[model samples]
Target: MVCGPDVSTHTIAFNTSFCHLRDTSAEADSKLSTLIHEVTHFDDTFGSFDSIYYLRESRKAVGTERSKVKTNADSLAGYVVWGEVFYAS
Candidate 1:
């Protein structure tokens, strides 16, 4: 799964793997920030066998699913907010 420029609004699953901007050059800071954001979701869903099994067995847990989405959204929002603050200061 290749994430687009606006991955913040994208909904991605745990099983889905992505390699976005395969050719385009991205800044190190930008890439690291993106990776940090994406990895949080990956860790939450695939951190343990129980988590993996839960997703597989349920075909998607409602609460877990919602929580993951919220977490990612909040993280991105927070990143932007703090990044602005840091630059302004």
Candidate 2:
């Protein structure tokens, strides 16, 4: 589910499968993060919380140079497509 462009509310389910893509560990981890990020949005009880806030804060703590990071660092195109699927549902 893509929540908003204003926030990182996009998500995919854990049970959902992906195909035609190479199954590698990094890809798996990236997908998992995308899932967790999106699932966080689906819970009404926790939906009000901002996931991106923590993510950006954490990145800052790690000294990641903001100048080098893409604005859509967490957005995977496949995940975005999956989000569209959720939107249609």
Candidate 3:
């Protein structure tokens, strides 16, 4: 997936595999929210090597999915929140 900068235009283009996983059966608002979620990734890695390095290392463990718990849309939205909460406990 290619996400645009954090400006007004939150444009994103998903590859065929991603499109298949993120089926169009979902509501438009939900899809838009998913796009916003992806944009957050761009926001995190905008110009930070540490963030990029973290992503690279994480991918090795989680592969492309980035989560060992759940690979659903919820993971995309809540991974960071859940990780922080889980670690705080």
Candidate 4:
């Protein structure tokens, strides 16, 4: 839980694991992916972040499902992996 909208606190702590990469551009930050992925999980019953719904998406076999893969954002959970800047699912 390095990316923390820490419970009972007013801060979101980012995990800087990608900071050491030679690609210092913002696009190189891995957190961008995680943020887009988890943002889709906000469709939960409470309209908030929920793992139950997250796991449910992982079970979808129709086409694009959610877990932790970079593809599309609105339909799955990711930004465009090719030729684009972002996506959300």
TM-score of each model, paired residue for residue:
0.24, 0.29, 0.31, 0.30
lDDT digits (tens) for residues 3-89 of candidate 2: 333334443434334343234333233444444445544444234334223232424422343332222223222224334321221
Q: Which residues of candidate 3, in runs, are more than 4 Å off?
A: 3-6, 20-37, 41-50, 53-56, 59-81, 85-89
Q: What is the C-alpha RMSD of each candidate to the true structure, in Å?
A: 13.5, 12.6, 9.0, 7.9
C-alpha local distance difference test of each model: 0.33, 0.35, 0.36, 0.36
Tens-digit per-residue lDDT, 15-85, candidate 1 = 23334422211222233344444444444442211222211222233334544423343233223434432
* Clashing pairs in model 1, backbone N/Cα/C closer than 3 A: none
Off by over 4 Å in 4: 7-10, 20-29, 38-76, 79-89
RMSD of 1: 13.5
In every candidate, how many clashes are there?
0, 1, 0, 7
Q: Which tens-of-lDDT digit does each residue in 1-89 have in candidate 3?
A: 43444444545666554554432222222344445346554543322112222222333334443343133332333344334321121
The local lDDT score (0 to 100) that residue 58 gets in candidate 4 is 30
CA deviation > 4 Å runs, candidate 1: 1-29, 43-70, 73-89
Ranking by TM-score: 3, 4, 2, 1
Least accurate 10 contiguous residues by lDDT in model 2: 68-77
Error of 3 at 81 (Å): 5.9
Tell how far residue 7 is off in model 4, in angstroms: 7.4
lDDT, residue 10, candidate 2: 43
